[model samples]
Target: MKTYLPSTSYEYATVQKVAGTTITEASDVLAAEEPLEIRLGYGPAGQRQHRTLSITMRTPGHDFELTAGFLLTEGIIRSRADLTGILYCPDVAKDEERENVVRAELVPGLSLDLPRLERHFYTSSSCGVCGKTSIDAVHATSCPVLPTDGPYLDVAVVHELPARQRAAQALFEQTGGLHAAALFSPAGELLLLREDVGRHNALDKVIGAALLAEWLPLHQHVLLVSGRASFELVQKAAVAGIPIMAAVGAPSSLAVQAATNFGMTLLGFVRQQRYNVYCHGWRLVNQQPAGGPDKVA
Candidate 1:
């Protein structure tokens, strides 16, 4: 068993702060961000193939989990079994750059659709995927439609999530510039949390941790984000089989639509003891019908 600890997530910077007319030298904590290149190794024993899969700007910590989560969400690898090992590249010339590169070695003889992966990586980098095409691509992946059965959440429990997630965010509290993703039980017990400068990276770390722990198909838990929900985040959660996703901020239209299409319960503005349920309201206990007696609008 291996455990990954976060590297330096924040750094100190000296700045001058002006209050009214007075200026004073002060030290500020800034969230660290660096480029992490994820490489992949595959093929058979004798002749192995290696390629750079992605290079993302993220806070330097939880590098392994970030790599694992990125591969899983991209549909590059399905399970932990798909990977033989994940390690930082040791061939870098500089010490600072050593942890910036990681290699996820796939099981020998496993097949990959390289062209499709290239297309996905290109579209993601360019942000040029149309809404319909993006949703359709999600449907084309191994991700399944979420179950509508249970994990019935209590409104009171949901109200406490934002505060709880905030309190547990050590990096956010220090730097005040990080996003967080948290997993919680139906009873509002915080299960796992990860923080990073990038929202998606934070989520990938959480999902990667869950995958390492063999906790896939998170249909029985609720996921909460410190920021607004996006289509990419929803797609990742759907791929991980999470039934409920709540964000402290608003959700994009595409996020709402994708959640609806996936049969997931999406909640937004989850603070101050209130929230708006965009889709699948039936999963919330004691939720009243909005439009009329027969419907929940």
Candidate 2:
């Protein structure tokens, strides 16, 4: 297992020994925390103009996708085609700090609306969800229900996610405090997993990575979260076009409502070979012995 060190924390070792005897020292893993500035560039006629869009304090890795996915999920941009390029600023003098900031260049002729931009463009991993002004804002930009030809998973497939997520959770194993988001194929195979102090950031990393892979319309897969399913998580998944979502914890009221609205199947408290289907139960196969999973196409 790997460790995640917080930006400001000092790592120490614990000595193991019997009373009055010498012992061995074991290294402690610290949480990884840093500020990620998501900048944007826009211009017409093949030129580009840049602006500091927002800064989100997040765990390291996947900064490019995190920025691109954040914009897509926030409705700042619509699709991968709307992006010209996403990159980390090479001008940052510090090597460690250089990986913390990213610039996303929007396609020519595209610019964000001023009023939609936050007055203070800084967010931390601890407060991404509570920072929302209202639930209506999330609902307004929710993606339409994906076409029914979306992928389906077996009950066994759904059951394997927790363990798969656990295996990929190197950061969580070290810190024991991070949340994780994993993308799985329709067959329940883990595709990508990211850990962060904030659940939304984990999700954004996965979304961002998927976007970079040219895998938009994530309807072909499912998203699994290591924490409770919040409304914002549902909104992000819907925006990414993932048709199914599962969480190891409970679902918030708005999450269930939003999942229902977006025609996504929402599963929660998934563990120990059992789970609760809160919305769009039609997506779960073999849940009821009476018949097969519902066909929506």
Candidate 3:
């Protein structure tokens, strides 16, 4: 853990046999949930400026990436060059809510239109984009055209994703209340995973980690979610240029629509041995026998 300090108490669960059935209850206690305030800085050297952007309810560990990814997806900063540095406020330790505040300093000349960003508040990783007045608005800030020749994954690799995703969810193993988001290579190797009480938070954590590592435009990786594929999750992946997305649960109509619009592959209901390909079925390699002709895999 970050070890800054904790405020509230968290109750980790324990399972018990009640009569004939096995039930779980909170008994062992752990650290509390941490809230982080994201701040942005801009303008000239003599009059450098900073503003409180938003307070996100999250664990304090990945604060930097969270800020970077937030700026990227919001279309505030296109590349890492736009940011000068990301750090906690100097007096954070003196503040009781130290885990609740962090700051990101931007490069000089990076301008932000407050009104435009305010309108974008309705569109975030957690919330779907439905408040648009017209389709033109969606076109204005939609995901950029991805490199069409990104890496490809074999069908067999996708079949193994459910088990891989489940194996990485340590928090979910204990609480059963959290959602997980993971990234895998085209060959089915696990790259990164994060668990959170909110589905969107999990995805954000992954995006933030990638941003911190300067790994935006994650075109070679496939994103996997432990739960249903929501429109917002697909939006985040598209923004990061992840070409393939899979989930162990169902996908909403909007999620499917977003994937189709972005030319990204969306997979859903990916259990142990079976999965439903929502879009871009052509990416799956042929699974035909050696002596047979080309066939759909």
Which candidate should be chosen as best, given TM-score against the real structure? 1
Clashing residue pairs, backbone N/CA/C < 3 A, model 1: none
Candidate 2, residues 1-297: lDDT per residue as tens digits?
346444442234464645567666666655666788777777885576677777777777667778877988878887788987888888777877666767887888786676557632333233554424444565566474565765666777788899999988876776677889999997878888887777988899899888878898888888999999988899899888899999999999878887887788889988887778887776666554533353221
Poorest stretch of ten by lDDT in candidate 1: 288-297
For model 3, residues 1-297, the per-residue Cα lDDT tens digits are 323222232455464636557565537534335677888878899898777887777654556777787777667877788888998887665666665677888898887888877766745435636723422344466466665775777878988988888877665565466778899999999999876666777788888788778888898899999899987788888888889999989998888887887888988888766677788866767445434553222
Clash statistics: count for each candidate:
0, 7, 1
Clashes of 1: 0
Top-lDDT structure, candidate number: 1
Q: Give the distance in Å from residue 24's predicted Cα in candidate 2 to where it truly belongs.
A: 8.7
lDDT of 1 at 148: 61
lDDT of 1 by residue, 71-158 (tens): 9888888899999999999998788888899999999967998998898899889975568778887788768767767879987788
Models sorted by lDDT, best on top: 1, 2, 3
RMSD of 2: 5.4
lDDT of each: 0.89, 0.77, 0.75
lDDT score, candidate 1, position 295: 33
The global Cα lDDT (0 to 1) of model 1 is 0.89
Which scores greater on TM-score, model 1 or model 3? 1
| lDDT of model 3 at position 202 | 77
